[model samples]
Target: MHEITFSTVDKPKLLSQLTSLLAEIGLNIQEAHAFSTADGFSLDVFVVDGWREETEELKSVLERGILKYKEQYLSKRHVVSSVNEHYQVKIEPLSNCIAIPSDGTDVWEIDTTQLKTENKVGSGSFGDLYRGTYCSQEVAIKVLKPERVNAEMLREFSQEVYIMRKIRHKNVVQFIGACTRPPNLCIVTEFMSRGSVYDFLHKQRGVFKLPSLLKVGIDVSKGMNYLHQNNIIHRDLKTANLLMDENEVVKVADFGVARVQAQSGVMTAETGTYRWMAPEVIEHKPYDQKADVFSFGISLWELLTGELPYSYLTPLQAAVGVVQKGLRPTIPKNTHPRLAELLERCWQQDPTNRPDFSEILDILQHIKRK
Candidate 1:
């Protein structure tokens, strides 16, 4: 086995990107370890087999792969500075970032002093999720990392708070309140003890038998229907964003990239995780609420198979195949016919050809009865 190591500035999805790079270079990783430095750099080491070549040749190939990876994933609309011979993407100064509108009301403003953080549960490039208490009630707090906070991050935070404050539904995570003030920005919601469906499936190796799968699908469909009725596009609809409470009722969570549908009823901006993104959105074409339906279809497949959408391909490669080759995950042969049909309708290339969430819910309910 050959050991490979990579060190770079820490960023969102960095580990996934690195793993993808190794896969592209024909490495079968046997073990991996990651560490983050106090100075915000990440060090990743991998033990792998599959390169039976000379050490110098392997080194050359890996260097080429790293260069290509940097160009494709790291240098998007940002200046690059070299550190220790590795390039780091630099965000434009805070002044260059657009200012967020201050038109929102402060009715849900929370007292930060009353907030008690217990432990960190998860983290992202710009924020960390914590399990905490508020007014003696268990809550989940998503706080922006102080060092990573910038104008662009703040704008997203403001947008999440703006949309979440108005939302209430049995299938949607309840918005408790938000600390919108600077340096302590956090959005609080009811704690989801059961965690995300993504973790349960991928991390815990949990399986959803047909009955349980349909129930989960119905719950997500109800939640998406509710959001659509409110003219809100979740934009990112995947297992990771679907959380479960103590009672095992799944609720939609995470609105950091969600937005109110524009008055014109179509949006052109491309934003979402590529693995589950709709083709129209991937191509940067104007899309409507039906885009969420496409993602929901992929999420449904994820639930059915307990696997990532494109396990063998990188996210960018999967996106390219989705838009150009009309690629989709294969449905298992034993899948219920009606449910399989519903999945096909949801994956239709034309947005208008897809079934709405209401129809999807009805179909899932029918399957549950059969």
Candidate 2:
């Protein structure tokens, strides 16, 4: 009888291992113990194996199992295989970021080995967000549904690579790298452990604090200011798109909707979510950076109110209310008066009249200081 433990892996591996070993000599498992603990899991396996194979064959089979599982196991990266070999594997390259060092030796590529993948963090029309790693550093990986996403989206994936290769900003979600190989349309980015501002505002209210909110506002403003300065308009600015670092610093995300200055006039065949979009965008009028400004305004409202403005309303309903009923977001009764005033300026009917992101930055900074 040999007792095996799984600190991480759950089922099939252990059961498969037992079955495979038993099948080797036509033996049966008489006693078994599969116990779980916070630290790991344990299994006491007893077998009825009176007749056995040659010693060399048994060791060779065990060796194969060890090597295979070693690639899939982590947190124990340097796993021993067959008492003769040791190895570690990850899907991502071994570097702090995607860029290779100028002098060489820093360059690496993804190993074909299947990796340990976590459950989805967020799933959308685009794909599922997964928290994963390469080498040893943490990373956030987005896995797109190949068949579901059309060829147009594949172009957007290329655009992300182009954008990330040229741009850098403190408050923006940094793109680390991308996987373009077959069966994978993965985009990698720096891991944001704290999640998004939306979580802090509504979902995580029980754990929210004033200091965190102030920091988030400052970081958000900084990120927007960077985009505005670069003449980039993030048409899809929303809560789920905003990501946070371990320090609670906010970074504007989803530049897939961004419009470069020359391309700013291009229009989507349809439109973004009506609730967060400006009336002009909904009307399909010629628009500019102010479109993002409008979304930012709603995002701020979400921060103050601890709920998405008009989130309870359906898309058709929100549009009707905005166009006909003139539904405007109201300030949270308990919020600071100064913030209420800034939000009012942000949601103004005339995009031209709204403060530019440069001015917006100043306003948020002032509020943070107070």
Per model, state how many residue pairs clash.
0, 0
TM per candidate comes to: 0.75, 0.65
Q: Model 2 over residues 95-166: C-alpha lDDT tens digits?
A: 232332233423223442533356678876557888887556687877877544544455566566555545
Q: Output the number of the TM-score-best candidate.
A: 1
User: How well is each residue in 170-276 modelled by candidate 1, as lDDT tens digits?
Assistant: 99999998876666678899999999999999999999999999999999999999999999999989999999998899999999978888898987544678789
lDDT of 2: 0.61
Question: Which ranges of candidate 2 are over 4 A from the true structure?
Answer: 1-116, 206-211, 263-270
Clashes of 1: 0
Pairs in clash, predicted candidate 2: none
| C-alpha lDDT score of every prediction, in listed order | 0.81, 0.61
